[model samples]
Target: MNRKKEILEKLAFIKSHKELVSFGVKEQEVSHNPCLSEAEIAAFERKHSITLPDDYRFFISEIGNGGFGPGHGLLPLNKAIVDFKLRDKPNISLNKEFPYQDDWNEEWIASFDWDEEYPDTEIVDAYISTAHIAGCLQISHFGHGCTFLLVVNGNEKGHIWFDGRADYSGLIPKMKDGHRISFIEWYVTFLDMEIENINKSLTNSTTD
Candidate 1:
């Protein structure tokens, strides 16, 4: 199937699943407010000087904007921008190139003295700046500040990453078979996992 058709089919499958519905998956208006049209997307891209990844671009344009996706839900483009601006430091520009070639060092984290007056805010700010992807957006939230990010620019463009800065301290690629997965792959995997969980739950319930 084509990309558009594949995305719509997957979304429809999610919506139709009874287990998914019980888990709070619901469809929302794609042709209304909060959802972007091709014109709006073009304008946003021009303003930001960056283009969204193909899979993600298709999603917001063809599927839905903010109301129905992985984790809590996909964030609307505008909302994602607003949130990023609020959290980002003034010196760091979203359009600037992301610096790191790999995930932040885990060993370096052990050197920090938790007892001292360490500048967690400043440290995290630096990390975010270095890891920032020019046109990337937060596509899903896993609660407590963890999010799935779609890379829209730079070397890792078109890949989805797990932003565990809130809990684990840095961004890491969502890998499968030692390769980073794209937005569509990640979304499909998520849906499959949810479906599996639902089936297991039903089986357990019936046994009891």
Candidate 2:
């Protein structure tokens, strides 16, 4: 389904209403970056050895490369890759199957529960190298040590996940109504909420 028409309409409304405090709008500070062409997107996919999820692929090619969405704003597609390498090991690559179906930090912690008096620094070092982020592309920094990732391969492809491991919350899927939220769903929710906030702000001002 084509969302370009609908998404642009919301973006236009948000951009035109400068007086409103739309979510992430001030952080973006301007309209989003220019849209990338289909060829540009294809080239990126080729280089990365992974096909982006349909909605996200469409967004970069049709809406904008990146800028303004959830949290501190979406990042440019080129900057979205996770470093999946652990030490001298090669990257696991984005096309590899995403390793988890649910929260994974607990598993990670269990893997290296060293003695408090004699911590295994090498094991801890490996954990910090981002092995858990394999097969995903980062989309947003959710602030306060949290990140948002888009699963790039395997069964979870196309769904957004919350990388909350920094806060010891684990890698959790973004869910709504018991289902994982897709890229489009996540984005449209942001647009809807921002529009609602703008309308409320305008209404409150008029009544005053």
Candidate 3:
């Protein structure tokens, strides 16, 4: 029962069932920008040398502070409830539209395939908005965890994932002059906090 309380009880069951499945995060209005200052995240981990754990620097300084929005701009992919039972697991694919290059773009690692993969998929959460301002980030690093997330909004750019799994004609793998980026309709209205300290520590669990 460690691993940071199992990733905070799977983000409190994704923030409590996230309104029975949508995109979770209904009313979260707290602003005052200019965040990311722990000496600017330790100088962005000493100029990208690495070592930014502690649960991804407390999940980007506390569960995505000053950002995570969909008030109007874009970048929102809330589809949980186990994503409709892994929607026809030919690997699975739903949210479409992608291309926005830039962000460790070695051709987006050819959408992952570095020699037959499968270590819990890959990408673990990403969001990039174009115009105005809107940002969300996640990437739980796996099989060589270094992680990635690039948020920009003026020229528009968005990528969202939290563990990869795109195959069934999801058509992932683009970078021939990348600049696609789309999916920004709107969702994620989850709000159901306080779970009695995670159901009283999972009902006094004894390795069920």
Candidate 4:
């Protein structure tokens, strides 16, 4: 599929909608930010020593670099490291391959004992070192402490994982119809769901 074209077309549809606010789109949220130039993207890749997943790279380069996307919008590449505190923690490697292949068992997760005396930073650091994807970059904040992780290396390269930090310390593959989806697919699915909600709202309003 021509994901780039599909993304652009859906964005245009969202932009042209008259009831954007009703659809949960904030003013100037779509197509308002400057996209990254090829040079800038290249520089980022060179500095990180890894190639970004193609769909994500294309979105930032061709669509918009930030300010409009799934969740709290795609984070700017420059701010990603700091926003995610990748530098503050030495163990979080942006080049290490993502390590997990499956979701952590719920019962096993529940077994984690929270030490009241344990420093929050230490707890977070421990999790980061053990579970965080080494070369994965956060692409979006899905509200309630959830974020989308794009793997740039390891077996999961090119796949997007849903980070459910608010509820649990686990990464779940973003799946659709039992199949894993890419960044574009995830975003498009989100948009489509929003559109469906908008239509429902409109229909209900008319009937009332």
The candidate that achieves the highest lDDT relative to the unseen native structure: 2
Candidate 3 lDDT over residue span 10-103, tens digit each: 5457455343323223443222233355776776445433334344355345444334333211211121101222323121121222233333
Worst 10-residue lDDT window for candidate 2 reads 83-92
Clashes of each: 0, 0, 21, 0
Candidate 4 residue lDDT tens string, 1-208: 5777876776777666636434345634666368899999999888878898898888788777777677777777776544353345343356677886677434544666666443367665555453565677777777766678877778888888887755566778888899878877777887776566667767888899
lDDT of 2 by residue, 1-208 (tens): 4478899888888878756866446657546788889888888778878888999988888788778788788878766774322345344367676888876765656555446543367754655555677788878888875788889888899999998765657788999889999999999998888889989999999999
Q: What is residue 93's positional error in candidate 4, in angstroms?
A: 2.4
lDDT of all predictions: 0.66, 0.77, 0.32, 0.70
Name the top TM-score candidate. Answer: 2
Off by over 4 Å in 2: 22-24, 82-92, 107-124
lDDT ranking of the models: 2, 4, 1, 3
Better of 2 and 4 by lDDT: 2
Error of 4 at 106 (Å): 9.2
| Candidate 2 residue-pair clash tally | 0
Q: Tell me the lDDT of candidate 1.
A: 0.66
